[model samples]
Target: MGDKLTTKTYWESYYSHNHADKKHIKTVCGYYNDFWKTFIDSKNESSTIIEIGGFPGRYLAYLSSKFKLLPTCLDYNSDTSQIEASFRIMNVETYSVLQKDFTKYKTPQTYNYVLSNGFVEHFEDYNHILDLHVDYLAPKGRMLIMIPNMRGYIRFYKYLVDYQNLKIHNLKCMKLKVFKDFAQRHDLKVIHLGYFGGFPLGVHQKSNLFQKLIYKGHRLVFKYVANRLLLKKPSRFFSSSIITILEKQ
Candidate 1:
């Protein structure tokens, strides 16, 4: 990984140029919102949440729609006008957006939940990054971390389909034991650890017709056959992402 400043510049430029489209945001927000709602349903409506690396605030907007929350979004990207506009479009009020690096940012108050998705893997010093997230959690608060599971079947499919630009992912893999060790080091209890989402056949988007057909066929199998057969056992080998829920001790 690059130096802190170099990493910051990369993300700033990335976000500045690659804002998610409304449709994509809606889809991702819906997926993540389901997980949040399921985990937090019993909590008070006034629960506070801080989403580190929440660039477009789509997840924040979704949570706001379901519950009265105190949301704070932190990201290195300085220009968040588009994200603010998205919040307005979603009718989400009472949220704060901060332009700061999570590894160094300090908060006066800890939160009920600290959330991150596709964030920690960017850094070489992921242990430090994990510690930073835990520092912002109140006692017994939950930290939700989601990252691409490179060991999963999606990687194998990409290789088989000869997916273009496979080298783009900064981090190689997020192993299950890595997360368990991180939680143990911080004295945080691992409440939930599992893989979700189906195979990522979408990575072959730029490939040939045969590759595209394979992608679609695999998607259907996951949707119809694999899902029914494997609903009780979401394999780390096949799932696209790994989700880890930890509670502060």
Candidate 2:
């Protein structure tokens, strides 16, 4: 909590410089796709949704595309007007609230789906962060938390390109067991939880012949061998993220 990584100022700079208008990524792994449909109908246009720590609101845009539902973006750095303007261009109906600290934000409102992507792993008091998500969730609502696979083998690539960000994340929060235990501690129901999103070889690192061969070889195995045999199940060694879908109990 004392570290610069845990500070709101750090994240404000991060969003301002990097993802100010980052495009919403559409192509997700098959497992996530199935889980999406299993948890929510594609035609869903009425369920209330919220994305915490979503600044510049890219995931909000993505969710609008995925579920055809309007989602609220709750972030300290968010500009409701800017986000809504962008969504308007994209024909998405959305709203945003700018709040510096989610833990202290007062709200009687709860959402049907509460979500955060790459959010919890930055804090040492990650459990407390998770508690807030649970608190904002409506009864029977599901909260989806996704943390990057920086603790796994992919960390090497992340370190090579973005070591500052690598240090920004608390690696301890990336473990699958942490979320599983957290759900149990809170008496929440684990809808679906595990390491997900197939191998991430798309990290564009400067490669020599050796690295190129290694990456290409793994990409081949990931697409043809691993995905086929494992049914595209994500493993810690190759997965890009650890995702948990937990229902408030």
Candidate 3:
């Protein structure tokens, strides 16, 4: 599928209707913040950070507020006319937000930190965007990537879930071994890789208090037991929402 048509159908639909879960949103923001603090060593205040696929400006704004650095966000959703005015606000003074397809846009500037949360997998060609970002990065620059795990527990339960009927799941997920090989081939160092979000498979069923309690217990056990023993692979957790930080050599 063409980039324009595929992006609109997948991103706009999710941003408009599916991304309303407060807990999921919180986990995402926290993940990025921790990554920044761990990797940047308080030096992010002076660096240029670019966030790809930042929707509605919430997480970008949150990161901007935390690091005190302006984040340039590139997104495919150009129809800002449909988004709420409150969702359009950004805090960075030096940063610019462009609503364009990254695959087609060329730039002369390099960034200190190139970050994309749940974006690279969406494109038909993963290496294409990865090469672009690596080329766009300054020497010693780092990149933070987050994508859904294809082998994660939640992905197995998709048939039992109704709201996740979207076809973008391919873009949303990747096998870890394949990803590691790709990163190595591209000269991107995988400095860290691990699970972040709790298994998303059972989150939907936790609508009621009783279900929520049971789900919470299940999550705890899965994290320490099922994931460590039964599944043995960390990717089996929560449909394997994997977060990885890569640095260009």
Candidate 4:
């Protein structure tokens, strides 16, 4: 736990307050839908699935209807009131809700597919849990992970505006190289990896229309300058977020 705030309390409060914040939550759901479509691509909807760190289970509810089955949702904080409420609201069946810490929980079975959104970033020992997941992954099964990009231009701007700092190091940023190396170490194959929000209108949500339009334009302009002018070199430091897909090697 970090000294300034307890992680469990932080997450509990976040989900409790933000789960029903319609616009923001729906925008997040849209991102999940888009990313899942990219990976599944017309596959049968009744695929066996599991989601680690399934906060509030809103995505799980959406996915259950779309995929034709309720997914098994696992979380470290099952005691959170929001978590319990989510389970009731989502009407999730066939779940193994555990309150155990993620670092201590071992993977139970080789799943056909495992999905996590904004999960790996919070943990200090992320790789260990990742390795466990890979070990329990069925052959050819896929693991999808999404993370905020630490080196993104907007984050750079945030550093200057919010903290008056020229640079900031986001511990959550898992560079592609580092991810690839981790995969290789675990005998997992890197199937697909890329940025999510570096194009016009790519943001999931914004506070207002003006902010939306401006940020959308900012994303496009930066992407153009990063890709065309810099020969995509700036991409290493300019993507707003990252999505990684991996298969067992």
Query: Against the true structure, whose lDDT is highest?
Result: 1
- Specify the highest-TM-score model's number: 1
What is the C-alpha lDDT profile of model 1 across 175-220, one tens digit per residue? Answer: 8888888888889888888787765555623667888787788978
lDDT of 4 by residue, 1-249 (tens): 331112666667555564634454457676556666655524665666677777777666555545655366677764545554554554545444556665567766766777777776655566665665665467777788877665655554444333322122235446777577778898877777876554222433223665556665665776656445443332546555678888775
Model 3 ranges off by over 4 Å: 1-5, 17-28, 80-91, 163-166, 171-173, 202-239
Q: List the residue pairs that clash in candidate 4.
A: none
TM-score for all models, in order of appearance: 0.81, 0.77, 0.73, 0.70
lDDT, residue 238, candidate 3: 55
Give candidate 4's TM-score. Answer: 0.70
Q: How many clashes would you count in candidate 1?
A: 0
| Local distance difference test values of all predictions, in order | 0.73, 0.70, 0.61, 0.60
Show how many residue pairs clash in every candidate, following the order shown: 0, 0, 5, 0
CA error at residue 213 for candidate 4, angstroms: 16
Candidate 2: misplaced stretches above 4 Å? Answer: 1-13, 16-32, 41-44, 65-68, 78-82, 201-231
Q: Write the per-residue lDDT of candidate 2 for residues 1-249, one digit (tens) a residue.
A: 353256766655545533324343343222366666656556647788888887666666666656876577787753355555545645675555555567678667888888788888877788778877877788878788888877667787566554555777788888888898889888999988888766665643366676677667777887777755444566787777888888877
lDDT of 1 at 47: 86
| Better model by TM-score: candidate 1 vs candidate 2 | 1
- Per TM-score, what order, best first? 1, 2, 3, 4
Indicate the worst ten consecutive residues by lDDT in candidate 1.
164-173
